[model samples]
Target: MNKKYLQNFYNQYKVFDFLHTIRQCGIISFWIFLSVLFTTSSSLLVQEYPGKVRQYTHTIEFDYVNWTFDAFWQKFLQSSIRLEDYLPEKQPSGIVREYLRSVRQISQLESQINVIYADPKITDKVAAAKSYQLQLDQFNAYKKQLAPYAESTLQSQISTILSENGLTLIGQPIPPVLYHSTPLPMALIVSPRNKIQQDANISLLADMTAGDMAALEDEVMKNLNVSALVVPIGGVGIYPTMVMSTSDLSFLAETVAHEWTHNFLTLRPLGINYETNSDLRTINETTASIVGTEIGKQVLKRYYPDLLPPESEISTQDTTSDTSNPQATEPEPFNFRREMHTTRVQVDKLLAENKIDAAETYMEQRRQFFWDNGYMIRRLNQAYFAFYGAYADTPGGAAGTDPVGPMVRALRKQSSSLAAFLNQISMVTSFDQLTRMVDNPPAG
Candidate 1:
């Protein structure tokens, strides 16, 4: 009897361990999925999907950013980390400085292309997208050229970023499926791993509504980041409508940079806990946006100034930059970065009042206010921001800037060495630790 009892206990222990592991691997609902669900735009189901691209006569031009993709990326990431070098008169270690500088170049290029394509320029390519077939052959050719580079350079860095997390295969080495028409918002994997199908479009996911958000929260993203809803919708949406995955060199130049920032802080335990909180979420995105944009800008300046030109004039398409605004309808005019900053301010005031339900109500009210302001904002909720935090910001109690997103503003005030800051940050295990390192470091 004693032997039998011992065996049964062992079996139960095994089952408990097995259950715990599985439970740890899955997702929870993001509160944002509860925000809004509209009647499926019959438009989504229309027999012929109205293609989003436009038509033009001039053959669409594929302007090279000039620098060999590798050189461009290296300089970009270097600039991102140099701030730390400037900070405290110290700098990022060579390895991390190289990694982040390259990442900055990659992310900003992605943002730039997204903005460029969205603008009224490139009529030929736009037309091709709208059923006109233009010569994307050059674009395809460049993509092929950068294929190995992205797989090796950008993807590898991404792995380093996600080393601690089990989700290491976010980017694969497989060849991309090339489409004749420009797939809007390139690079999206609906089902994890190789689903035997491919879509490069990964820009604006705005059409999603409350119910769809719920389904996705219940069925998809929540399993990864329960606060996925609060996560800001990434990718460019405007005259230069674009997404994370644009081109190959650009892929290395951008997508890897921005997305990897998400992978970095996401490995932390506490950041995961607040993944469902809006204030926490904004802090994450704002941080990443600021960092990523700065890196991108500097990289462009150094390596591909021609492709992005030093020109300052806005394209006709960029009427405004004002979304992510707890107050606006679009992501620009004020742009996502500034909007995030302001939202940080607003969410703080609302939270201090401590009328919790009222605060929640404000989410929907603000979203509705978006519609009232003439822009289409699907839903608003704590979940929306929660999932958004993965990008760059973190939960700072009262909700300041996150430590991750690729925002430029943060770098503006960074201490001596980008390399030193990165070295200290690389080993951190939680968002709080990362922020503390950034905000107040113990003497070396």
Candidate 2:
């Protein structure tokens, strides 16, 4: 590994370590996962970009070093249990169940910590990754050293609530998994290529496509401190992890609904082979975002009604609740969703007419021409739809569907129930099959 990349990973480590010190705070797949899929996808990811499937099951360590943010998890559990007044009723076995849950949670966490440090952790594909470091395992050991004792106390308090509420719970381990890191918000780009030093901005992680990034340099490896709390990593099973500010807990379910969709699909990124493939990246993501949005709304409406009502338009205030102390300003209504639904129908028809170029041009100027002339631009053609599809909602990527999204959507559509959906897709064999199975799911 380039020392510089090692250094960069260490820098990320230090930042996560600091974030952990804040006692701070913190904080998924019950399917409703499938609904995120069962969406509008009807294309394959592999043919679009070859050699997509890479590995299986990422181990994400979700650490909450600071206890102050414990409120988020506490609230999340309460929403599900609906235990408004836990103290009013308590069962004698409650204490034992709560303790057992805690033990199971922490014990599993500890075992993972041990595995991370083991030499075998990266012996497979990760071993050859340009950014791989023999000493990176120690970062987990460092994280273990920094967990907030106060947070443990907070967990204890949370345990009491579970005891009284007729529940024995360990909140989904912050999904996929969370990690305690020093206060740095940096991320290390590890894969067959080295790009950590090349793309150091935190914004890039949230913005750029992993497949299109520049190559990593040897000098860049020396850029960081190994002792930092390197956290919630992005790997096979552990990714799309985000940092939330002191926003309201109210919208977390929605956020979880969104991210968990990524975890389930396990999209194959393009550009990992250094420009060998790029289209796959887009297909995976666009599919995921579109699916996630649809599924999240449906899940919220189906299971957690109080958090997300059926008939109401989701307010920005609710979505950003984690950060707002009292007031998260209201977001403007997106009447576009209503209008676009119908427009997409027509747009697809145009795309299928074989005048893709003409369709795209028509759609591009439709909105601009109409907005300037004072008319609604409803007939956006296929080309324009393709253009927006590449936009992929939350930034990053040059074009097409998001690999993660499409796979999840495809898997769900194939299975009758969520659990069955997960079981079949969890361990796929080939990238070709993975893509074909979902986008062109067997006709039912």
Candidate 3:
């Protein structure tokens, strides 16, 4: 009845509980493994086609198999430790906050170190970098230590919200709501030059330099006669999910939930048909976006209400002022989504007319325009749209004239609840099915 003896007893009980949980959920895990295997093999098959593209990218392509093995092992160790379980009732939130603060501090130190190296006046650049290296390393170690606990806390929080929304299976979420924050891989998106379509999406190494990305893109485009772009992504929907490391709690929550949604769908017909066609991909991405945003907002409101943005800040208004006093207020801020919508609409039209050169030239001009307006779009072409256009949760942006997104949104509006919307959509195998469902919702 000493502290050490009690702690040992608790640890043994947890092991028993873990074994029980695994015994009950082992089938689900097996299916998830099989689904991931199918998805990865499908991607490899797609990469193999147009073998020249792989020839150029194979050396630089991300080794997801090795990465997954490492990540899964790390996750297994963390699960065994269950560090968050030992925290006081209210301590997890503070731990998460401290972890985020450490992440921000590390980011600041990294920026400062880079600035030091770049300064022409700093003759001893190595020494200058070394000046801040100790602090950076300290913050990095703190972040690493806190990461597992933070991840567990957030996962539990998200799972609770999902359960409240009735997205649970047998009192638990499918896939058990797991995620890991790390440097994410870059995606090389390839599209046909004549049309805007994502024919291939290959993950590349996280540390690949801009020059290497550009060179690989150029080689693929020239060899395959395709429009190619190297783009950064917020998350990848592998098992235990891969999320980009960031200090933004809102984005982190949404991405974790978003990737979980992908795992949820992976066991269903819609996800099974995800790679079958472009429309299905759009539907899948859009569905995940909607679910992620809603669930993320709920998690924030329940645990980190102070961090939530004000209502007025949640969305941008097109109107500059009240109707009675138009001159009373400043002009509306630049809307990225609205402008991107216009660009997409125009590009779609030009591509339809077979004006490839004109479309390319126009996209360049618009890219520059976006840059001038603080958007900093590196490259805006068919591949860019093809890659980004899938996440059509909102009305505008890269979706342009694609009717799929609006239809998905409409279905969500028509459904009784988030769970209902997801259940109805998850069974959909094609856009036609979605269109039919939306057109003729069940009479309630």
The reply for model 2, stretches above 4 Å from the true place, is 1-175, 179-240, 243-252, 263-279, 286-304, 311-364, 369-411, 426-444
Tens-digit lDDT string for candidate 3 (97-170): 98899999999999999999889999998887985999999899989988987898999899999999999988
Which sections of candidate 1 miss by over 4 Å? 1-211, 214-243, 247-252, 260-291, 309-357, 372-375, 389-414, 430-444
Per-residue lDDT tens digits for candidate 1, residues 188-269, read: 2221111111111122243444564455434434443212231233432111112333333333344444433433334343
The CA lDDT of each predicted structure is 0.35, 0.35, 0.85
Better of 2 and 3 by lDDT: 3
What C-alpha RMSD separates each model from the true structure? 20.3, 19.9, 3.4
Q: Which candidate has the top score in TM-score?
A: 3
Give the total clashing residue pairs for model 3.
0
Measured against the true structure, the TM-scores of the candidates, in listed sequence, are: 0.38, 0.32, 0.91
List candidate 3 stretches off by more than 4 Å: 1-49, 317-331
Superposed on all Cα atoms, model 1 deviates from the true structure by an RMSD in Å of: 20.3
